[model samples]
Target: MPRARPPPPPPRRMEAPPLPGFSEEQFRAACRELDQPAPAAGGPWQLLVESMGVRIYRLYDEQSGLYEYKIFGGLADCPPKLCADVYMDLDFRKQWDQYVKELHEKIYDGEKVIYWEVKYPFPLSNRDYVYIRECREMDVDGRKIWVVLAQSVSVPQCPEKPGIVRVKNYKQSLAIESDGKTGSKVYMYYFDNPGGMIPSWLVNWAAKSGVPTFLKDMQKACCNYSKNT
Candidate 1:
């Protein structure tokens, strides 16, 4: 008798059905927020921490009862284009960002969508997000800038998993440009409501510690990107 055929490889995960299209108008509106100036001190924006040349601020959202964060800084020794590329590289992100449990992009109806699951500490359920994102290059007064925008989106195809909390309210914007040297000038705004009973103190602590840590990790990743890719 012929030797038993080798077992078939595991089937690939099925791609979700077509998602709703994110419009150019929506994308442009989001980009405008990234272009706006940072909120001045002594306003609703309260400064959280300033370290390593990065300033982080938080503003309370009355409607959501959550905090939104803004960051202004530069990534030293990392060029603008390289910095942006490293940020948008999802495959590489999985390798560097320890919090990223799962991240990938899928195209549906000619639009690309991102799915991400983040690992939370023990006893806390993981949080997952499905969002639409776009990136653009712009020239303002002869200065080149890169802008990336993302917001949560709902679709029937990506239903919430049982053990994970679905984050329905989330938005992120980033603008990067040359720092007049070999570094990148960066501005970032982020907000997300991880749907659960998580305490406010824990959330605030995570943001305060997490943002700086993430930027440092990204900077290190950027330094190694060319070799890795």
Candidate 2:
């Protein structure tokens, strides 16, 4: 008989935080990027659209052939808590998040580390990310808001898995604000070098079709959480 595998060890804390405030800085930068005007001189970013109240933007990185994208979630009926819970509940998230092929959480270096695999079209390699995430509540402009941020972290304990292309660098920020009733303001940013021979058409599709679909799905799930949970 084969030997049974032992349980994984518990997470450990670092003597000092690494890349302190990296996520916050990234989040701030994302906020600024969102307000900036679209380039007129024909730089990388050349696409913008608004559909179903969601403003979508895309940027093509000549250095990497990868595009950085952002989606502004217009006010939905989802409460801040419910909207935030859509992604926090990893177990339930996989069921509704159509883009995620696999996702699970593990503690590493005293932080919530997530293992995520994103589905890709056939003939293209799937993308994976190991990121440290944190959720915090803060007062923003005299109103309470919840901010959840995650960014790829390089750690020896979390190595790139086989059969998945690891995203060397990626940053995501989600800010949720409630109006004390049942309305929320949501914002998201995603940038990654998927590290594969992904064509321009696929990249375009991701910004044009993929982002809005994902956000709409999340909104629908949030609206249904009360019934399910």
The C-alpha stretches of model 1 lying farther than 4 A from their native spots are 1-38
Per-residue lDDT tens digits of candidate 1, residues 1-229?
9999999999998775664544656545444544554666579998888878778889989998888998887899999899989999999999999999999998655677799999999888999999998788766667688878788888666689999999999888888888789998888889998888997777877877778888999999999999989
Worst 10 residues of 1 by lDDT: 26-35
Instruction: Pick the TM-score winner.
Output: 1
After aligning candidate 1 to the native by TM-score, how far in Å is the CA of 15 from where it should be?
Answer: 17
Count steric clashes of candidate 1: 0
lDDT of 2 by residue, 1-229 (tens): 9999999998776554563345556545544433343444476555577777777767767787666776766556887767777768888787787778988888766666788999887878889998877777655456666677888877667788888899888877777777456777667777877776778788777788778888788888887677766
Q: Which candidate has the highest lDDT of all?
A: 1
Candidates in order have lDDT scores of: 0.83, 0.73
Could you tell me every candidate's TM-score relative to the true structure?
Answer: 0.85, 0.78
